[model samples]
Target: MTYPVDLIIVGGGPAGIEAALAASHKGFRFILVEAGEIGASIRRWGHVRMFSPWEHNTSPLGRKTLAVHGHPVPDLAAVPTGAEYLEHYLHPIAQSPELAPSIRTGTRVIAVGRAGIGKSDLIGDPRRADHPFQVTLARAGSSDPVSVVEAPILIDASGVYDQPSPFTEVAVAQECEASVDHYIPDVASQRGRYAGKHTVIVGGGFSAATALRDLLPIAAEVAGTRISWILRNADRKPLTAVRDDVLPERARLVEEINRIATSADVPGLTILRGTRIRSLVQLPIEGGSTDGSGFELSLAGDHAGTLTADHVLALTGYRPDTALLAECQVHLCYASDGLMKLSAALLGAMGDDSAADCMAVPAAGIETLRSPEPNLFVIGNKSYGRFSHYLLRSGIEQVETVFDALPAPVRTAK
Candidate 1:
């Protein structure tokens, strides 16, 4: 029930994999914890592909691991889909000898805190109490919950994919009087849910952009389908999209979204932008609605007049399970854009262009994904520091950074 190692990694997504690879090279022992399957986010956003191509998905450390193990590396240019990840990334790495022995799949880290930082324990002792580590469960889905793994340095690669916060649980939604059902993985596959229905979307970020882009195609094909885009500001600007370069991905994404908002029509598309949601009052559930689902939505807008909708898709944005982060005392940045901020300085430490690409998380300061509690690091889009690239590169940066922070590997007596 208590497996111990030098490094305790939480959340086995791209970040955890990269971190595991880095630790392997340094010969540091580690146990990675994940709540669900390796790539949970991909499962949720199955339809969409990354804006960045393949190059952004592999870590410098990962490519090396591939070569060292005689596995052919994936092309940097091929775009990955939800299905592609399992084949190209996850399957190969899991099969590789690089860090497979160290990884404990299906382990979910519940909570982490200070374990130890004493001198005796620092002398290569794994079992010493107060070892400054992390603890995890064998599998949350199992009948009996048991503590399974432990480690000294707990590097958190747990991205915000598993338990997305609901729309009703925030101050903004309450203030704006908006209602949302965030992170609906079943939205697309569960057709007849929003088809031939009037929908209202709220938010000004990528999630909103995603809704706008995807829904347009659906609306054109489906008759009697109408969806509205909403944001706090009438400008209806989407965060610009840019290539994987350093200069202005932020502005570029925002600007591109703006252009999309201008019309939102790309052949067989009937969509408009510049909409906002003021409030929602659900109608009584009735039998005639799609799949016997009923709930007409009343919406107030920023630019346009009030309208009624069959459904409301509030893509406002997402927040970290801050409730969980606060438990571990993982300090979060108070960003002006209403999102968590990571430290940007971490990117500066990357040596070359390749390293820079790995460290280049979208939002600044996510690279500062460290805790005051030594030997703890964060992985995933959270550590991206600025914008959430959600690429394997960010995860790669996480591993490289954490490895850089660890002590030189302990040699076992032959």
Candidate 2:
């Protein structure tokens, strides 16, 4: 059956935008949908500067596309904050003639599946590709009537930032989630909330490190300000510094944060290693009301005990949301929740000593981008699932790989 378009791309971030550009270049009819504005997730952490320079953050196709439209190129050596990257690169690409016409913002893809078949019907049969994919769409975050669109191919580039991992291995407490800051907080602007307050920070990744780095000066400047850092691992240095790191900014951040974790000399800073939050209760403030004024936490592990704080920073990273593809037969890794073949490739590289650094990860081949269901691809950070090492460069490469493998458009371009 003929579909409305040759392909449907879900997401409007770097990967999705790049895919749309590729689709246009390949002379295919395609639609790119974004749940929010382009680069919405990036805008959330816009204040933080990226470790990778502009060279690695953008795609060659994207740059070429923008250049052809007379858009100025960014300095390749310059590292951009999330805001700058969004404004200068992603936003422009989305608005470029190549992609703008096919893009839809504030439209969420609620579900996707073969139009006439259930997940079990095809069972590895080549006949499966004959059916068009039915994508359910609706206004983002609303319960209005849904619209279904059909496409022969679907590429899910939707990223993971919208879904943050809970602070513990088990389910998160509703009270804890409602009270803590999940995303990296803009400490400078939110000084009124963080200043002179005791904060307990959770997690061991770069997000956590960034929060710690940002809050240190605030703690020093504000009288009675205190910070208690909680790491799930017992390592003295929570962040691993790449040997002879290629990204100087990332290396410096690791070194600085690790130094703070090891030195124990920074006043108003307390590092609690190998700790977890067992329970958290909002305590009543001076007037005997639980208005989010304070928290009493029951801790577990190496530094197990009761602790009190005015704020909690749970920068524990994120995982991909796979619910939208529930009706499709996609193979996901048991551990990472990443596409199976790609996850195996990533895991294999991670096991090797030489591939210790994220930069050393092996490039994803076209085969790794394919799923059990034919003509469906999961690219970008979502393809990495819970893996935290996805570089923007990798997503660009994935877009190229997937498009290259797809068949040329059967009908005239829209």
Give the runs in model 2 whose Cα sits over 4 Å from its true position: 284-290, 352-355, 412-414
- What overall lDDT, based on C-alpha atoms, would model 2 receive against the true structure? 0.87
Clashing pairs in 2: none
lDDT of each: 0.56, 0.87
lDDT tens digits by residue: candidate 1, 1-414 = 233477777766677777777777787776666677666666677566555556777777667767777777878777666567656776577567876776676666665544444333334333433545445365657735577455656766666654333333223434223344454334467567777876676666666666666666667778877776655555544453443545343345456557766654643332334443434544444553233133344334435455666666665444455444443444556541112324434334442333244334342332355554455566665553334335565556556655666678565565
CA shift of 300, model 1, Å: 5.0
- RMSD to the true structure for each prediction, in A, is 6.6, 2.0
**TM-score for model 2?**
0.95
- Among the numbered candidates, top TM-score falls to 2
The number of clashing residue pairs in each candidate reads 30, 0
Listed in order, each prediction's TM-score against the native is 0.74, 0.95
TM-score (C-alpha) between model 1 and the true structure: 0.74
Top model number, lDDT: 2
